[model samples]
Target: MTKIVVDPITRIEGHLRIEAEVAGGRVTDAWSSSTMFRGIETILKGRDPRDAWYVTQRFCGVCTTVHSIASIRAVENALKIAIPSNAELIRNIIIGIQNVQDHVIHFYHLHALDWVDITSGLTADPAKTAALAASISDWPLNSPTYFKEVQDKVKAFVAKGRLGPFANAYWGHPAYKLPPEANLMATAHYLEALEWQKDVIKIHAILGSKNPHPQTFLVGGMAIPIDPDSQNALNADKLAEIKRLLTKAGEFVEKVYIPDLLAVASFYKEWAGIGGGVGNFLSFGEFPQQGGGQPWLPAGVVLNRDLGKALPVDHRKVTEYVDHSWYEYSGGAGKGLHPWEGESEGKYSGPKPPFQHLDTSGKYSWVKAPRYEDQPMEVGPLARLLVAYAAGHKPVQDAVNGVLGKLSVGPEALFSTLGRTAARGIDCLLIAREMPKWNDQLMDNIGKGDYAIHNGEKWDPDRWPAEASGYGMHEAPRGALGHWIRIRDQKILNYQAVVPSTWNASPRDAKGVRGPYEAALIGTPLADPGKPLEILRIIHSFDPCLACAVHLLDARGNETLKVAVR
Candidate 1:
């Protein structure tokens, strides 16, 4: 078996590494690792519980909003404080918009290159690309003239001898199956998405404060005081602006993002059988309705690729193992502890820098293996949709079935890499459609003079129980994100976060069970082991969130790649 290591896997906010063993042109084994150490859990200790949300937002610059929400939810859960109806509606809108924007960015910017060969677009006929784009959707920019201009813009970038965002990829690789026209069409949408994301995320700025860590999150509720008559608060003009932004964002998702996803997926139906790992999925359930009603996306567990029934998820059954991870537990290595009692510390056990393969037999990665009922499970958009579909959610059922019908595949086909990619679009569309309704609901509540956002019932520490503990779960854009906290004397005593990537990108456990990334790669075929584009396809499909991008290293521990950022 020949071993291949991909350190720093993703192009943005990525710090993961994968080591795979190839034999007979297919992967036979794999190990997943994280090159970065996270100390947020330790940093949060002994701090004011109310301010934890602000500090936890630093977990990831890109996923800042989700972390903020998750942290606040944890503190509120611990204090048994329920936010008011207006606060719930506002939070729901922000969460929904965040997921939609992330899904769009993941499809067009991050994962598309694994399928689309941007360099090949230079050889495409702009007119033919226009035809292809028009055939997919009635997006206004489908004119042949617009495509030619887009083609010219790409050609000019290459003329500069640097591809800018399009650099350092395995362009013209054998694994890229899309024709030149499709590649060109996808490239056009990619540029459009860069602009599209910026405009849509203004919802964050208007509602909270700004993007990449909105400042409105609080332990009891949001800091945004809702008052229509007050210009400084959520006034009539700001409300109108929010509604308009969401409406435009929805239009883009429906016309451009969803169309591009479906178009790109058509040529890769075979992927419906590739990279289906662990076959156990988890979702924390997201977008709860006002007044503690059912969440728009209910949480459940699907085991063994079973779509017929979704077992109810009990957060208590969630456990983490550190035997194969870099950290050790007080209970001993390989022991499973739920987040309420979770303990972690930075312990670097891998070989020093400039070293060859990791000591995979022992502790290798910084990511801890999270299990549901002692079983490793995959999380994120696919898991959320699968759980919701199994629970007979009509909208999710219809959206998933619609995609399956368009692709001419059965429900079983949804268990692959391509399906995972497609689920994000389905989830995006559903949430995009629902965002306007949420905005309208908020507006209606404001008209009814319900300006209460914070409950403030248990906001005071003087009324506190000496010790309290609770966990918060949010189905962030990538997957199920959970934060557990223990509060004592109005200060944090213990804190732990088992994020989505921790579940999917974890290494192994005492039983030698591979995490989702490692398991998914076990049977992946590599057309050329030296250039493993197939590996990128599978990993990108997971939508990994780690550190930032960097160059690759050869198996001999040589920095064989050098990339320039514009």
Candidate 2:
């Protein structure tokens, strides 16, 4: 048996340590650990509920808007307040843009390196690359000159021995399957997406008054004023600018992003069967229709690979277990507690860092194991897509069918690493296509003079019931994200955020059942355990945001141990 550890996995949002036991070149056992812990929930105690959104948004820079949305929803749920239709429409549009931007960044920047050999792009003929790009989509940027220019920039960076973002990669790893031209095409898009993301984020700034953390959200509705002539409100010029940006984003998703993903999947079709983790999926549902009606993404569970049997989500059944986590639960180490009554107390009882392997029998991670009905379930784009597909959501069904038809694969193929990756691309296209409708709805509401965006009825503390508790949830870009809050006298008593990563990157529970990340690593064949590029491909499919999963700061900032790998 050989142990392969990828400590502080690169090209991810935060610190994650993945240790897998390999036997005969196949992973037989694995442990996923969040080394650091940031007790954000503990800080929320005694704070005003209205201030929770601002504080929670700091949990993750990458997923700031989702956290902000969930935090407000939790407070709203506690107050039993319903936001206006205009507010809902505006929220959906912002979230839709965020999702598209996130998916694009994940594909080209985070996960693309696992598949595309950047060094090989130097060997690609720009003319052939242009032809390949042109054949796939009608993206106007697919030109020989553009491809050559990107290639030249890459060559210059490589020659300078300063790869920067392109540094420390397994450049010629055998697992890389893309052709030279395809690699060059993807590399070019990788650069293009950086610019594309800036434009997408500008939409967020336009709405929220900032990009990383949008401040426009309020407990009742949005903080943005609505007026046709007012310069400070969401006026005609801002609306037109948003439309223009959305159009550009939509064109990229349809023309560049989706096609590039499909092209990559074609070369790595074998991955369609690998990395099928836990087989259980969950989604909290997002993008509600008018009057707080059913969400576009239905909330449900798909158990044991049975897509035909999607059960409606019972939020009551959700609980977090700290049996194998660093935190101690007040009830007991092995007991499961719902988020409303959740406890987050730090207790690191395991071996310190610089260790070879985690004590999987004991506390191994800072992230608590979250179980649905005590069952380990996977969450993210794959879960959202599967739930939507199972519930017969029309947009999801149409998109899934189109992709499956193009790939000539059955639905079962989606339960793998490749499917997890492809689902994000499919989701982007679906959400991008839906963005214009949301914009139209918001515009119609404004035109009808239904410009009411905030509900000041619940703004006063005296309006509270003295004691209240509620859970706010959103199917974030990552997956099912929820924030549970308990308030008394308008002040937060307890706050727990069961983020998407907690569901996907959790440790073992009382029953010793491995979470989604560990389960997915089992049976994965490692071409070179030392490099472990295969493992990265699987984990990155989840698009982990560990900063949201676990948080801590090493005040000393000392390097304890290092092992050189050749």
Candidate 3:
């Protein structure tokens, strides 16, 4: 048996390294390592509590809204305040827009490459690709030349001396088995998705400003008020365009993306059984409203492995163990605590000869192992699907059912790798369709003289309860995201964050239980270790945002990549 490693897996948002114990034809053990650590939590120390909203959002450009929401919620929880109904609605719309853009990008550009070989498919008959695409969807612009245009653009990009985005790609690798026609169609959509993604991002900027880190979200309410005189009138024409585009995107998912996914998945049905995890899932829930009442969606963790059914996720039950990390904190493996009170006092320094192993049991990722109720659990689309499935959401249930049926898998198969991936596309479609309704509602509220901003004087830290701490959790596009903060003497003394990827890609815990990504990688048959399309397929299925995972910097404070293949 020999172990093959793909460290610092490229093309995704963050840094990750995958190691698989390959014996004969399959992987018996796998480890997903998240290297690098950005002291974002540490950055928040001594700053105004209200500033947490803006500062934390910088953690991820991709899912800044979720970070903003969670940060604001943390301060709100500390101050014991509730936002107005209109504020909740606007926040929902902001989050929803990012979700739409993220889903579209993941489907076309990131994950699609793993399943469909673009270079191979680019050579196929554009006419056939266009015809097939047109037959599957009602978009009026599908044409052979349209596909050819996409190929031209891709070739242009490569020719322009900038294939940075397509780095490490094996353009014509034989294992990338896909018809040229199929690749052409997918390539066209990939280019289209890049454009569509920017359109959706505009919603964030108009409301927040900037792409990754939005500016409008504040602790009490939206920083940007919606009155006509506040800045400008709510442009009905622009809002309508956004709504129309979102609807069109949803339609495309149903008619184009879903069908394409099904057809391609048919050619790679073996993936259906590979990358199975520990059958555990977790979601902190997202889209918050006033009080504890339901927002557009609900929050909770599905500890099905323990309860045999999804249960209410308790934020207080989540803990982080740094035993495997390069930190000096010492305690038992399972300790449920918030980030604010987290202990980050260091015990060891760089190249600390005592700890260099990549295994969590000894040496591994800089990311701390995050556990719910003393156990590792999966997150992201699959977890959300199971939660939504258990919650009995009609649209989610129906859409997932359709995907499973197409794959010829039973409903119970939702726990597997293939189910997680397909479920995400369906989730995106459902959420995209839901966003416009929210936008309409928010606009209506504005028409009624409602503005979400809460302009009261900032709360006094002295007025806060003595020694208060809590966990603020929200769902990001990647999956469940949370931060725990503890405040004493009116300044943050401790801060810790258990990002979505920590749950999905963490190493083994003290109990020897595999993390979600680790467990998912087990038993995956490798047709060709040299061409790791299957590995990338499962990894991208999680839509990892490594910016939210770990970061490393050199003396100049610039992040550098470390390549170590085992």
Local distance difference test values of all predictions, in order: 0.87, 0.91, 0.71
In Å, residue 32's CA in model 1 sits off its true spot by 0.5
lDDT of model number 1: 0.87
Ranking by lDDT: 2, 1, 3
Stretches > 4 Å off in candidate 1: 547-566
| Inter-residue clash pairs, candidate 2 | 37-551, 37-552, 38-551, 38-552
Task: Please estimate how well model 3 matches the true structure, expressed as its whole-model Cα lDDT.
Answer: 0.71
Report residue 430 deviation for candidate 2 (angstroms). 0.4
Score every model by TM-score: 0.96, 0.97, 0.90
Query: Mind giving the per-residue lDDT tens digits that candidate 1 earns over 246-310?
Result: 98998999999888888888888999999989999999899988767678899999999999998
Runs of candidate 2 with Cα error greater than 4 angstroms are 554-566
lDDT of 3 by residue, 15-42 (tens): 8878788877777888777666667777
Ranking by TM-score: 2, 1, 3
Q: Is candidate 1 or candidate 2 better by TM-score?
A: 2
In the range 39-126, model 2's lDDT, one tens digit per residue, is 7998999999999999999998889999999999999999999989999999999999999999999999999999999998899999
TM-score of 1: 0.96
Top TM-score hit: 2
Instruction: Kindly report which residue pairs in candidate 1 clash with one another.
Output: 13-547, 14-547, 15-547, 380-479
